[model samples]
Target: MTFLETLLDPFQYQFFIKGLVAALLAGGLCGLIGVFITLRGMSYIGHGLSHAIFGGYAAAPLLGIPIVLGAGLWGLASALAINAVTRRHRIGADAAIGVVTTASFALGVALLTKFGNKGPAFDSLLFGSINGVSIGDLLLLGGVFLGTIAIFTVLYRQLLFSTFDPEVAKVSGVNVGLMDTILMVVLSMSILATLSIIGVTLVAATLVIPPVVARMLTDSFGRMLWIATALGTAAGAVGMYLSYQLEIPSGTTIVLVNAAVFLVVLLLKGAKGLGRTAGLDDHTDASATGLVTASAPTRA
Candidate 1:
């Protein structure tokens, strides 16, 4: 096949087309929410919620219900429970995440074992295959992508204020508590949105690595959002293509691509820093800003 034919070959198939759309939507949405996730230091929350959703997935089949709905509810409940536990008690957020997530995951594993072959295959749920995406899945992913954009657009200022400066935002009447809840809700839904495309095991990486890489490249939040989204979208498309050609797992390929990108950016950033240290790049600007620091007040 010619180079152009090789590139266009995947697009000739309906399943491949649907998979690409799903990947782009899931990746972009994850990238958008990931900015806030990274800034707020809630990476663990993403991982925890993804695992917690497995509980609902394992139970939904037994109840004759849709797995997505069950998993979404479970993910949301986990997010809220973690928020409530950390806020109402003296315990740290990570501790609450550990307690809630592990228990939920264990329940999922036990249920799966008890009802072997009744539910969807454990391998499919844990490590997704993008080629399995259907029209219905594409529609759901589109709805989620649109909804996320609307929410982010309407609440941009409040969300940004609360994320970077919660105390100041509260003083300015931003309703820090409510904003935090909103963030959690969005985070939960984002995890659910990516479940079918990336699965529980690797979804959190999609929600994290892109934003971290974007953060290394830019100081401005707006730029970071754009860069992250672009990076994620590109990674998803490229990874899917590579996976198809290489006959590898889609979720694993996508995550590995994301990680590779992050590593490359990290090395580049380190190199730049070293150049600055050696006074080899006097024209280099100062490090980017807007990332959360240890001194910043964080909401549990």
Candidate 2:
């Protein structure tokens, strides 16, 4: 069936509709923040936050709290802890990520013993069942996505500058540290928003893969972000289809589909670049560097 026909011939399945909505919101948010994640070469942080979200997820059942809210706080705390440790102790981002995320997640798992009889549902945080998604989840996703876009509108130039060249950004009067911290919070929040739809485990793929794909196609950072957002949305929708037909987890299916697309686009674009640079062995040394370059964005 055509795309229009498939969507129009709805089975009146409210759950299916919910799943689609969830994917769209989650995918869009991940794609947007992913622009920064990719530019900064900090894909590992996204991976760490995705898993660290389990801290909040584990807290919900025991403390009689909402998992998303708990996870958001968990993510924020994890980000701060990582930043502090890395700053004060001369630890790196990767090492800090391992220490904070694993520790927080382990604590969450350990605290489960106190809430006897009210066993925490495993899938609530790990493997999201689309049917369990409520209207509140949709609202939270919408709020985060819109808020992120608004913030980006105001700070895009600064973020782009800092991501491309922290030293220049600092010298040029941009608040690189403050911008970095705020972006970290936004990223942690984005990961939390997507955790319900993509699950804590699969969020890294949704965030990193889309931007990675976009980077191959565009030389300009702003254009790359928009392209990444589009790719993410497409992957999200296709993932929903994969989940429905395969009788599998929607979030996992979505993430896997995204990964496949990323691989395909990367190879395709890389080949195209090589083909163009084939004969220019000495003359077009610039083009041989391919599309990726370190020309920093200018701050406003």
Candidate 3:
């Protein structure tokens, strides 16, 4: 087969096409939210919340409820609980996260062991089954993507201010507490949307790795968001294609691809730093003069 034929092979099947769309949407949305997650150093929240929501998954089938609905509610409640506990009790954020999330996960495991029967397999829930995405899932993802864009568009300034400088934002009447709540809610929604695509085990990586990679590539937040989204989409698409070709698990392949990209960027950054050091060594006198000039003060 030719290159184009090989590339287009997966598109011939409806499930593959759906998986492609689902992967891209999941990756892009996670990447978008990941910027804030990274900036606020709340990456653990993603992991914690993902695990916490597993309780809903464990209980849903036994209760004759939709798994996504149950999981989403649990995830949202977890986010709110974390926020409330850390704010009200003066607990460390990490400690709050660890306590609540682990408890939720433990509850889930217990519930599943006791009540789960011939429902969705734990493997699919934990590891993901992107190729199993349905049309309804696609619609849900689309709604989430649009909702995310709308929220960010409407609250960009407040969100940015709160994220980088909460004290200043609060002094400026930005409602830092409300902003935090909003961010947490949005994060919960993002996590819910990503659960099926990447599954609970690996969804947090999707929410983190892309932004970290983008941070390595740029200093501008705007550029960081765009770069991260693009990198995530690219990783998902490429990973999906690679998984199809190799018959590997899509979620694992996607994460591996993301990690591979991160490693490449790290190497490039290191090389660039080395090159700058070499250039500085070659231009020691010029560098000293420039440094002195840069440090000089001017009188108005």
**Runs of candidate 1 exceeding 4 Å displacement:** 1-4, 271-300
* Candidate 2 Cα RMSD after full superposition onto the native fold (Å): 5.1
Model 1 lDDT, full chain set: 0.79
Number of residue pairs clashing in candidate 2, backbone atoms closer than 3 angstroms, sequence gap of 3 or more or interchain: 0
Residue lDDT tens for model 1, 91-154: 9989999999999999999988888646556776787786668787787778877888898888
Better of 2 and 3 by lDDT: 3
Candidate number achieving the greatest TM-score relative to the actual structure: 1
CA lDDT, every model vs. true structure: 0.79, 0.74, 0.79
Predicted structure 1, TM vs. truth: 0.88
lDDT of 3 by residue, 20-86 (tens): 8988998898899988887777888999998898887787777878977887788889999999998
Q: What is the C-alpha RMSD of each candidate to the true structure, in Å?
A: 5.4, 5.1, 7.4
Q: Per-residue error at 123 for model 3, in Å?
A: 1.2
The TM-score of predicted model 2 comes to 0.85
**Candidate 2 segments whose C-alpha is farther than 4 A from its true place:** 1-11, 113-120, 272-300
Question: lDDT tens digits, residues 22-81, model 2?
Answer: 888888788888878866667788889877877777776567766677778888989888
- For TM-score, candidate 1 versus 3, the one ahead is 1
Please rank every candidate by TM-score, starting with the best. Answer: 1, 3, 2
